[model samples]
Target: MTAPSRGGPAEAAPAPASAKPGSRMFASLAVRNYRYFFFGQFISNSGTWMQFVAQDWLVFHLTGSTFAVGVTTALQFLPVLLLGLFGGVVADRYPKRRILLTTQGAMGLFAAALAVLTLTDVVVVAHVYVFAFLLGLMNVFANPAIQTFVPEMVGPERVANAVSLGAVNFQSARLLGPAAAGPLIVVIGSGWAFALNALSYVAVIASLLAVRASELRPATPQRREKGQIRAGLRHVREHPELIRPIVLVGFVCTFGFNFPTLLSGFAYNVFDGGAKEFGFLTTAVGLGALAGALMSARRRSSRTVVLVGTAAAFGALEAVTALAPSVWLFGALMVLVGLLSVTFSTTANSLVQLHTDPAMRGRVMGLYMLVYTGGTPIGGPVVGWAVQHYGARAGILACGLVAVAAAAIVGLIALRAPRAGAVAGG
Candidate 1:
């Protein structure tokens, strides 16, 4: 929607409108659309992370305990687990750009409302929980639309680069958002952080509105049908390439990437540190992930070996990270852990998007997201219990082993299925 050229916020509005929108300008506008999305999403993702940190801070301030904070998080994610499939159905059945406009606008409004509530001294923990749920409810519909919209901006040929760039945006925000939030919270309170976050949404909204309809190669919207959701599920089940990466990612994420449990456990027990130390380790991971995302952008396509091999490497390295003799060593290896983790994620995401029928991409991607994020609810407590009983290193080691095993199992199945198909055909 605009050009600040990554230098200042004031220039973020008003794009060059001299060129008439037509087929001759096709290539330029397509590239421009992708840029708009990338820049808009970059700002939006940062605000999201800021909102997350501020929300947790507010909850703790209100209740004076972490229990309600944990509950707030649960409320936020519960909708995703319950209604995410329905979100995919909506994505397939509607124009993604239109759905995005409504959802993104809704989210920004929610943030602004929350800011007003908190700043006015009328806020409570329950209000935080409610807002959290509302934001998540919006995400249920927004996420699938967002994911499937990627190829439309750049065409199918550049989907991998687009997805990798998206990952880079996320990791950069992951590093920066919380850093910004802490200072905002200390200086002006959580309300200001929330307000700033609300303002950030303008970038995305403006970009979405500014898009030329002729530029995007959007997937043909799936028509409403009785069994669309079930049909999407069946579609995924039938595709080994899609299902294998999805399942591999699910295992790696659940067991290998239980950050809340594993990171906290190691931070306190192994390093004898606190929140600052925890943040240091997290930053290291984010840096590595950012680098990995950059490296992934150069690749033209996703492959079976890269997807499976990265998963296996990610798992083994995670195990090795647990054995580090010092914090320096641990943090260094954790950087590699982050790199491999994002590489596998980007690969898995691209592979799924590139292979799936555009008609069913939304549902398949939705299932993929459910499997990836859904692991935390199951794995976090399990890893926490393991750390409590067996110790942090042992818990992390087990997670790593689980990742390697999942990768190996999926790799075997993928290799065998092709031969199995040949025999069945004969």
Candidate 2:
């Protein structure tokens, strides 16, 4: 199959090439390949979210320890910290579609293992820890491959729109998954939720098989060389636009995005709620994220001000949520927090992908995932410890304060360097 040319839309006639810049909200769907990818991810992400809720609940139930919950979260992301750079090298050297197929299958198998253990009534906290680490190993490769695959489906012209729409699909699943998981766990069982998640992988694998190979715009495969990882690091260090946003994300993600630890602590300890209430809390955040992602889709371009401003608002909202007097009030504030978080994350993701060179995109995204997710190993333990000793409220408050500080520090740096601002705005 012939890859799409890097030139004009005239080179590829399979997709609707007439989609103008004015109608970019769903512009990536004009390509048949992206349409398949979109629907596949929708179903798959929903299943993934269901598993997330079920796993958290199961761990808490088995241990009744908030620190155990944090350990689970940390184990799941540890591989990204260890192998993320190597994963990027593999993504740039191999076919992403093939890599996704392999990794998705491995993930499904892991989910099946968990379901069996739970159904047999023989599952323990140690089993959960082992499975989470294995899944993280798969993600070390899958994350970078998935991140860099967006451009191949829609080409560079619609990359920003494609990225935003991807978020919409993910957040939409986030909404559906928790909503269903709560009732399903109540009526059926947590094991069945894992079974359903395993089944959902079939949809994504089928979609991968159905995509037209000829429609893809694959990057030139990178040659094997020494110091490739260092080269990727140097690339980001030299590019102020990329480095600044990544630094901001590293702080917020490391200190702020410990929701699993925070929410689990809040539901069980603070709110004194059950599984159903925990599900509701997550669903509320998902709804807010969906709204934010839709708003981001309408934007023509991502800017520095939007990224920094939304992050600041998100931090303030999270801080206030820690002080809510009732579960309903806390849930309400969660909506605003979710909205701002997605807005900042989606904008930052697009900014990094759009500005970086195609050949180096995978490596850069590998580093992005490293910082965005790998921090959990460090932050989860700290947040979990705080929740266990102090209170859920205090743990969440610490998250908010750190986010606000990071945004402020990055904002001040940008102001001092006019050229960095220009790069971000561009």
For each candidate in turn, the TM-score is 0.90, 0.88
Question: What's each prediction's clash count?
Answer: 0, 0
Give the range where candidate 1 is weakest over 10 consecutive residues by summed lDDT.
3-12
lDDT tens string, model 2, 231-283? 88988888777887899899888878788678877888889997666767877
Best by TM-score: 1
Candidates in order have lDDT scores of: 0.81, 0.83
Error of 1 at 162 (Å): 0.4
Residue pairs of candidate 2 with colliding backbone atoms: none
The runs of at least 3 residues in candidate 1 whose Cα sits more than 4 Å from the true structure, single-residue gaps closed, are 1-30, 419-426
Q: What is the lDDT of residue 136 in candidate 1?
A: 81
Global lDDT of model 2: 0.83
